[model samples]
Target: MPSTLPSASPGTLQLQPDAGAVHLRVAGDWTLAHYRHLRQAVERARAPLAADSEIDLSALGALDTAGAGLLAELIGPARLAQVGRWAPGLPAERLALLGTVAQALDQPPAELPRAGWGLADLLAHIGRSVQNLWRQQKQLLGFIGLTLQTLAVTLPRPWRWRVTSLAAHLEATGLNAVPIVALLTFLVGAVVAFLGATVLAEFGASVYTVNLVGFAFLREFGVLLAAILLAGRSASAFAAQIGSMKAQEEIDAIRTLGLSPVELLVLPRVLAMLIALPALTFVGMLCGLAGGLVVCALTLDISPLMYLTILQRDIALSHFLVGLGKAPVFAFVIAVIGCLEGFKVGGSAQSVGEHTTSSVVQSIFMVILLDAIAAMFFMEMGW
Candidate 1:
């Protein structure tokens, strides 16, 4: 070769001899002109370094696919070793093409050193998880805050629209739930009376069966059973409704119209359930008491008059109030869990269905757990 390589801009090539290494020098950007000269130089040196050849590309300021493709070709068929600082600002598409060629030739880039585990890594992972949880909490709170604001404005303006939602939710949650709640409560009462009668009759205390059924139903069973039913019926409905809206882009449409779906959809339903649950619980209590009365009169031969007197003596105003108080709390919990799962609905219809089912099941589980905690607290306080 002449003092200067004949072909390209201002790059000189120097061959080093361990096995095969080429030092490529360049003054400015290495364009296609430099790449052609690089190939010619490699061809001239190939036979001499047949066992191994390394093309060092670290000096180039810029390289394109033409250059990368040429390097890929030599590294593959010629079994050359490629060592380089690839140019910055290389297009992703070109890099991907080069990676594919390298992979096809079973020439993987060298693995970088692994970082050791330390306190820093543990803290980093924990921090990320906490941050994610915080973000979810913020989203949930934002939804509630925005819902309250929108309802404050809309309820004063078009309050009647909310009434329809209330009616709809009550019809779905309360009316639809009545049959199951009534049947279950009735059976529970009958079971209680039968058990009390069986055990007490031997001791000549069968009349007290009335007191057992009345007290439990009035204070605990009525509210607990009603909450469980609503958890299954209303919570699932809320999740399915909201999740479907999310899946169908209805929530997005509400946003586009400057409306909060939480207000228009969720708050009304929650309000309705709050109002309806107490009434439903009260009805369920009455049905349960009636069932107990029937069993007491027929099995124990206690007169209905005697049953009523015993119930009146055993049940108190505070007992009724406690059950009533629990209803709204249960309503709030079911509404929150349902709406949370609903908002979790992803872009797919399958996600909508899966989350709706999970919402109902999870709400039921939470209701039971909360009820147990409440019972413990109340018992500790001598309730």
Candidate 2:
């Protein structure tokens, strides 16, 4: 008599010597729970498994992907393709699992190349930077052309002029800024006069301090100072205002109504700057000369009469014209750069701040660069 009871078992492999080949029998659960012992069992039995071995899966139990992978390690990928002929009793799903695992294990992932720190890398970085700068300049040039085209088309009609907006921006960019611009130029003028007096006095020519102050302010410092001030002050303001509007989706709404943002938002600011900057430059020149005069009266004891005489004798109208002429160009570039940056906003507070800072930096750099070029041109042309 035999007892009829279910038995618990670990995975096992047994080899039997047959007529001309070996019979390899697999049994029990080939799962994660039995992975360690199953692996060791397969390792020990796998030595006898050759191309002509017989695989008996009829006695095989449960299986999973881990076990399938271990089976692959034992059988090798080439044998996995012919699993059907080797183990005819194996289920279709189990055959598929074994094939998949064998393929995955056979083809390992390739490694990624690491970056190097060398001269080639440095040159590559510089090339990328130059490309970015060129792209930015192209955008600026295109924007300028678009603004001019719009101006040409719109300015011919008096009815479409944005008078109220222009007035408001003019006051903000020009009139309200007068005090600060004037004060800054005045202080700079005084410093220049002091330095001139000190240096010239060493050569017994302290009286030429008046001529130095007049020539400096009339030809360079006056317009340069005013433009730089507006770049920092008004350019940031323009970028912030337009950026906030963009972030709030007001710009999108404006476009939905078929309104031109360039005309309504940008042109007014640009025209205002165009009108205000020259006036501001003139004021800056006067204020700077006054500051120099005061410094000379106090430090060098040069009379106001003598200072005027020296200014009239030494400084030509070309110097004044040269300084003032640069104002409109500076004004237009600053305004365009500011508005362009504003339009570039990504509809977020952080993006607005970043563009606002960018506008100011770009405006100042352009002003200085254009001024330098203009100086060289005037000097070459005998102005």
Candidate 3:
């Protein structure tokens, strides 16, 4: 048995060494108030504890969680348990509390393994990205094919047509869009004329600004601007509208009522876009030309009559046809992409917003890509 040590003050430790063991005597207020001294004593007593050491907690007074935690850390959990077993004279509650703290502080938390930065990991990431891209392309193509199939099936049944919905969509997607499209194309036309005048004036060819504006607006800029604006405005609107219905389970409800969502919801919007875009393109062309005429009159001193005469003489009918011909194709693509994205929405408001944004981005990208291909084809064929 270890020799009895002298009583230590509150927040103090007394270490008494025996032949082969040490007795750790703790007494007084072992609490937050005396934490500093208790911590120092615990630290000093740490080196003396061995496998044969014993902790005597029977004399301890006013023990709390913090002091118990410090004691556990110093003596380690295994010896702390032995101390509890040997010192039954200690309060049961205090020993139980010490055991709880010992268990909690005994082990450190496990760390997560870091990812490898080897060539195999890099190649795997690239392969996953490629697979995702391929999957997305397949989904888009399948959607396009479905839309076309629905159109073919529905076209022969005039009795099934929803004229009111078609008219409403036309007014919403087309008539509502006119002012902004006209305004944007008009401003762009004026800017183009100004640029042409500034650049060509160096070569004493300022009058060519009229021809440049006429050619650009008729062949490219007018339809391109209108289509891009509709992509941002109308495509997003379609996605949000259909996505909201999807979130509410309204599409499923429609199907339960023996109605086709594609025919009822998508066809009207698609047809409306197809009809509206051509009219919008025509308006954009006129507004663009009017803007160029105004710039010519003010800056180049070219009268309206001379501008019209020059335009008629230099600009061919084929230029206008080339631009107008692309409108229906662009409109079809935008409408289908928007409705497809909307149908893809999951049952959440966040899903609606994400797919809406995606619809706009995809529509704009497709329109630009198609326009570029058409332009290259026309150029190669000398159309």
Question: Which one is best on lDDT?
Answer: 2
Candidate 1 per-residue C-alpha lDDT over 221-325 given as tens digits, one digit per residue, 9 for 90 to 100: 998888888888888888988998888888999999987677778888878888778888998898888889889888888888988887777777777787778
Q: Give a tens-digit lDDT track for model 2, residues 110-218.
A: 9986677789888988999999999999999999999999999899999999999999999999999999988998999999999999999999999999988888888
Tens-digit lDDT track of model 3 for 228-271:
99999999999999999999999999999999999999999999
Tell me the spans in candidate 1 whose CA falls farther than 4 Å from its real position: 1-50, 53-99, 104-161, 380-383
Measured by TM-score, how close is model 3 to the native structure? 0.72
Candidates' TM-scores? 0.67, 0.74, 0.72
**Candidate 3, superposed: residue stretches over 4 Å from native:** 1-125
Best by TM-score: 2
Candidate 3 lDDT at 248 equals 93
Q: Please give the range of 10 consecutive residues that has the lowest summed lDDT in model 2.
A: 2-11
lDDT of each: 0.74, 0.91, 0.89
Go through the candidates in order and give the C-alpha RMSD of each one to the true structure.
Answer: 9.9, 7.0, 7.7
Cα error, residue 139 of model 2, in Å, equals: 0.9
Enumerate clash totals for all models, in the order shown. 0, 0, 0
Model 2 score (lDDT): 0.91
The TM-score that candidate 1 achieves is 0.67
Worst 10 residues of 3 by lDDT: 2-11
